[model samples]
Target: MYRVWNFVTNYSLLLICGALIALVWANIDAHSYHQVVEYPLAFNNWVGVDAGYWLKKYGADYGVTEVSTLKVLSFHYLVNDVLMAFFFAIAAKEVWEAVVLRDGALRGRKAATPLFATVGGMVGPISVYLGLAYFLGSETYDAVVRGWAIPTATDIAFSYLVGRLVFGAGHPAVRFLLLLAIADDAAGLIILAIFYPSGELAPEWLLLSVGAAVAIYVLFNRLPQRLDRGKQDRPNSTWVRKKLSFWPYLIAGALSWYGFQESGIHPALGLLPIVLTIPHADRSFGIFAEAEQHLTDLLNHIEHILKHPVEIVLFFFGLLNAGVEFSSIGSPTWLVLAGLLIGKPFGVLLFGWFAAHPMRLGLPQDMRTVDLFVVGCVSAIGFTVSLFIASVAFDSSTMLGDIPVQDAAKMGALFSFAAAILSVIAGKVTRVQKQNG
Candidate 1:
């Protein structure tokens, strides 16, 4: 009973619940859902705070002669654009840590297979998506060509959860899947930063963002050295140094986030540069060995503090983004479904096989080919990041318009639930195989 209670209260379960609530609310009373999401919260409008009044006042600032209002972001925008930035920041930190930290997943030759598999996973789904779209004729091809990156994402939490259920605790394949997912996340962040933008590129702002990241890196590296040089042998010196060190990173992160926003790139990428800039200890001791060292590392501290907050962010993220109007589902939805369901596993397996043979790097001793295949199936659960890309891919008013394309993308993202079922069945088969062996 206690275990069941713990499981239900887990972050994965919370995310699932949030998504389910959004789905039910949107389907049952879409008008109410829309109204709630669209409800205006005025910021710097200089008006009576009414949506209409704020719009007119906002428009005047831009020298528009027309009686148009400024673009006021809805509650949904606040959650996705604002809150999700922190989520991405933490995610970036995790990916950076995995690569640079001692005993990290990406540290040695052992990681080669999974790294290759990650690339394969990404390339495979996108190839399938584009091929399917092209074969569907011009209209479908044109509509979904930009959405190739959507199904390439792997929801770390959902995949991890399904992995635990299927493979039980402490499976090598599960760990491998996690490493692949982290790499996939890094790739996804790059794709979002490079591919999705709201307006013309502002290179100056991008420079500022990079500059801020460099500044943070410099400060992080130099501060401890300077402090040690002073050599104050006080009992609380460690605590003081740790506390003081965090402010620079906070300021730097804020600056970069604002810069990315101004630079017409997704602000979530702001953290990626900063994350890479943070120094990590040699992973000689192993991946989990840095627990003690994390106390002094600002990047690790920031990630730890964000662990709980990210859950809240994910909930609101789902509430805002997962409200798919199922009735509006169409052909584009199949593109997403096929890309994730079929393309994901095929790509993973194809790449894994190549890595094992021609590449001369074999799979982990404890893991079988079937285990890798099941991991690929688990990777098919492309939830959070996939939905985010879907939103970005279909957001253009000039090219693809919004509602229909966005809705179809959402339907495909929501269909990741099917992957959960596949994980369970595959997990059972693997468990039985393990017992028989």
Candidate 2:
């Protein structure tokens, strides 16, 4: 419980604070809030939103009549597209370790049930969100259909925190929830990369990203170990670690980021390739485990160094992305909320039961079948990633009647906090027995 709370305070509290501040500011003075958010930090053709798009969207507010010689690097773009890459890089690191490490949580038979449940968690939300939109009419459905992935997100930090509260620290469901959340994040990244493009696709430019990954891995990682083979001192690997450190990877990541931006992929995912190339310990201590801080592997070292910066990035991300006005709450908002609150529990429960029963996979000892629903309820707190997906899923210019689709969708993401309270109630209604460690 202490560890869970500690993790939340370390990573999520500032995000929540920024979100709350944005909500209040947006409601009170929307124009000013938006002005600050869209304020141009730089004007360069190499980065940020295109000049024509910026002019068309916001030039009137800024009183700019002509296209600038350079593009606009708004404060919003700096935070969401560039700086937030660090946050997602950290996420990718955890996912990479979970899948690649020998003792990874996502490995082997133990993960089967949770993985199945994760699929359901995603499918259920997409079905509910899109299905309900279809009923709302063609205009509404077309406006919000792209945001189907929003409710599939499960914020790992908040979910872990709530899981501890609902089922206690010792319950197997807590661990199961963590696994599901991690898997969901992994899937979300893939969905974002595939389904959501930051711009027009250019497959050739992805070569730069792939090339960077391969080059860095071979030159810095593989070469060092190969040279150190059969040597007790491991001189080459040690020299690379002591002297070069993470600089090479940073350079490679920057190149990859540029590649992604140019390739019309979200730049926030740029660091993902670099994460895989970094050398890591063979074993694992799990996400947010205290023991992980002691690991000297470059991967862990990078994550440790990134911790503070990523927190700040997340704070800014929340501040910039979560400033939807109260009036923005409409059908999309309800659809997002319904997908999360209703779809998640049933999806996890039904699929989890199937896996544990007919599929012949079994739950962890002492973890009841009903606990899967509780885990789903806990996983439905899709505050952070949900907000992110919503931001990318729709443009601010998009409207369904009077309501801005992006803002309405974001409102739904913000409202997902309600899942926390609902989870507690579900635990009680289902007669959950808390198992304190």
Candidate 3:
């Protein structure tokens, strides 16, 4: 319990603090807030939004006439695009370990039921978000259809926290919720890469990212292990670990990030390929496992080094991306809420039942079928990743009637905290038995 609270304080408490400050600041003085969020840190052709586009969109408001420049790297871009890559890399490491390692949570038949439920979790939100838009009218559907993936996100940290509160720390449902959230994150990454490209697609540039991963894995990682195969002391591997350290992978990660930026995929996912190339321990202890802190592998060491820096990045992430005004609460807000609150529970229950009974995949011991619905309720607290999806799904210029669709959608994401209350109520209504490990 102490470890769980420590993880939340280190990662999520700062983010919530930043978000609350932004909400207050945005409502009080929107103009000043916008000015700070868009403040340009640099103007160069190599990265960031095009300078011509920025000037054309905001110059009249800022009383500027400059248009012939390279690009504008705003404060928002620095946190969301460049720094957030480390956040996603951490997520990818967890997912990679879950899939690749023996005895991993996501491997073998033990994961089948939860994996099926994960699919339903995503499908339910898309159906509700799109189906409601269709009923609103063809024009409404056309405007909001792009954001179908927004509600599918499940913020792993917040959901896990809420799950522990609702079901005791020893309950199997908590582990189920973790598995579903991790799989949902994996699916969300694929959705972003395929559907919401940052710019025009260029296939040739991806070769650079792939080449960097392959080169580093073969030259530094694979060669060192191969050279020390029969040697008990393993001097070559020791020298690489001691003398060179993480420099090789860091250099390769930079090249991969540039490749993703030029290739039009979101640069925040650029570190994923490099994450796979890092050396890891042979076994797994699950995410947020207290036992994990003692591991001496390079991957875990890198994750430990990043813990504080990523917390700071998440703070700026909330400050920049969560500044929607109260007036922005409109149809899209309700639509997103409905998708999360209404669709997710039913979707999880129905599919989870099918897998447990018909498909012969069983639930964890002492976990009743009703617990699936409560798990869904906890999973619907999609604060962090849902807010991120809303940002990339619709540009600020997009309008649905008189509302800014991006801001409205963001308000919906922010409101997802209500699901935490809903989850507690559901647990009480369902008469969940607490089990302390």
Each prediction's TM-score against the native?
Answer: 0.85, 0.99, 0.98
Q: Which stretches of candidate 2 lie over 4 Å from their true place?
A: 68-70
Query: What tens digits encode model 1's per-residue C-alpha lDDT throughout 111-171?
Result: 8999988988888889888888899889878877878899899988768667666775466
Tens digit per residue, CA lDDT, model 3, 168-269: 999999999999999999998899889988889996899999999999999888999999999999898888887888889999999998899889999889
Error (Å) of candidate 2 at residue 325 is 0.9
Position 196, candidate 2: lDDT: 96
- CA lDDT for candidate 1: 0.72
lDDT of each: 0.72, 0.92, 0.90
Model 2 deviation from native, Cα RMSD in Å: 0.9
Better of 1 and 3 by lDDT: 3
Give the alpha carbon lDDT tens digit for every residue of 1-437 in model 2.
66677778878999998999999999999999999999877778789998899988998998887875567899999998999899899888888888989889899999999999999899888889999999989999999999999999999999998998999888999889989999999999999999999999997899999999999999999999999999999999999998999999999999999999999999899889999999999898899687887999999999889988888888899899999899989999999999999899989999999999999899999999999998999999999999999999999999999999999999999999999999999999999999998
lDDT of 1 at 151: 89
Off by over 4 Å in 1: 1-10, 43-71, 227-245, 277-296, 396-403, 427-437
For candidate 1, what is the TM-score?
0.85
lDDT of 3: 0.90
